[model samples]
Target: MLTYDVVVPVKLLAEAKTRLSPSLDRSARADLARAFVLDTIDAALAAERVAQVIVVGDLSGHVDEVPAGVVVVAEPEPRSLSAAIRHGIAEARRIAVDERVAGERAGRRSTRSHRGIAVLLGDLPALTPHALDAALGAASRHPLAFMPDAEATGTTLATAAAHTRFEPAFGADSAMLHRALGFHDLSHDVPAPLAERMRRDVDTIDALDAAVRLGLGAHTTAALAAREDRGAPGDHRTDAQPSSRPIDSTRKGAA
Candidate 1:
C-alpha cells in the first residue's frame, strides 16, 4: 500500500458556498461549509493510505473543532485556491522531511515511506475512507493522476509523486487543465466504487440532495438536520433554478 500526505484547502465559511444562498441563510451555509470540511478530514484520517492530513486555510474561529492528529496550517494571509493548495503541499513535504529526519536521528526504521501528496476537495461530504483509499491506490500507479468531479468538468482529487512538483490547477474546468498539464485521468481507468462517491462534491441543492441519498458523513448530516429543524427553505430541493445551470464562479474555488 502507498501512503499519501493529503492536503485539503478550505475557504473561510463566510465566503464559501454562495450558490446555496438561495435556499439557506448565511449562517446555515457557513455551518454546512464547516461540516463538509470536518467530514472530509474525518474520511481522510480513516483512509488506510493516508499518512498525514493537513488542512490549510483561515480557520481561526473553528480551530477547536479540528480533530486531534490533524495538522491545521492557518493562512491568515488570504490567497487564491491554488495558492492555498500549494501551501498545504509545502507543509506536507515539511512534515514528511521532519518524520524522516526524526527516524534517522533515533536510529529507528520507518514503517512507511511517504509516496507523495494528494489534494482532496473539502466539500465531499459523501467521501468515505474506503473510497479515498481506493482512489489513492489507483493514483499510486502514476506520477501524476487526477479524478474528475461528477460533472466531469472539474477536478475533485489530484496526486503527484514525492519527487514531482505538485502544481494544482484547481479552479473552473480544472479537470481539463490538469489533463492538459499531463496528469493522467484515473477515474475512467479505475472506475472503483469509492471513486464515484469521492467525485460527488456538493455545490448546489440538487447536489446536496444527491449526497444525502448517498448518505453523508456525520457532521454534514447533523448540519442539514439542524437546518431542517430551523425550517430552512428548499429542504434540500427547490425548483428555484435548473440543475443544469453552471456553478457560480465565486463558488468554484476551494472547498
Candidate 2:
C-alpha cells in the first residue's frame, strides 16, 4: 500500500570505503567497494514500494548499469552525501510538480505523483525484501519517519514529504537533529542480518570479512570468487565477528 520513490546516495567508490584501508590493500579495497555498492543498489531495486530508484551523482565508470527501472542522475554538484541527497529530492519533487502542472495545462486526467520520498544510504547488504516492505508500509501510515541505525546514532532510513524539512545534519547527533525537525523515530528489530547489512560496511577489514561470510552481492561475490581463484588457494571462510567500534547505543544523545 506504500507508494514512493527512494533516493539513494552513491558516491565515488575509490574515495569511499576508507575504513577498509587498515585491512586491505588498494585493489582489495576496490573489490570491497564494488561489493557494497552492488548489494545496496540491488536491495534498493528489489524494494516493492520503491517506484523509482534515483542515483543522484555522477558514478561514471564506477557503477555499472543501474538496475533496470532505476534512473541514474548526475548531481550537478558532487560535494557531500547531503548535497547529493538534496539534489535528488529536489529533482523528485520537480518531476512530480511537473506532472501535476502538465496535467493541469492539458486539462486532462491528473496523474498524481508520489506523495513523498525516502532517503536510504546505499550500503545495506543485509537488507531483505520483507524488511524493506515493512519499513515502507509503516512509513506510509506516518507523515514523517526516522529509522535509526543499529547503534541508533546514525540515520539509516528516513522518510519525509518532498517539502518536509529533512535537514541532513549528518555530522553527529543526527538522531536529535531529526527529532528537532519533528520527525518520529520508527525503530525496528535491527535484526542480525539487517544489523550486519546496516552495520559497518567495507570500511575496515572486519567489515569486509563480515560481508564475505554473509555472502556478498552478485558483483562482490564474483569479485571475491575471482580473488579466491587467484589467491594462494586457502579456505578463507570463518565466523565473521563484529568490529571494535560498535556505535555504543547508550552513548549521549548528541555525540
- lDDT by residue (1-255, candidate 2, tens digit) is 556777777666666655544444566655555566666777767778767777776456754555676777875663677778788788777777887899888987644454568887766655555566667676677778767665556676778754455555543667778778777776653344554454433434454566667666676667666766776332233236655543322221100
Residues 1-255, model 1: lDDT tens digits: 678989999988888888876667788888889999999999999999998899998566887889999999876365779788888988888777788789989998764354689999899999999998888888898999999998888988999976888897999889999999999998876555677788989887778777877778999988877777777665453223345545454537777
Report RMSD for candidate 1. 2.7
Pairs with backbone N, CA or C atoms under 3 Å apart (clashes), candidate 2: 19-203, 20-203
Return the clash pairs for model 1, or none.
none
State candidate 1's TM-score. 0.91
Once model 2 is optimally superposed onto the true structure by TM-score, how far is the C-alpha of residue 38 displaced, in angstroms? 2.4
The positional error of residue 216 in candidate 1, measured at the CA in angstroms, is 0.6
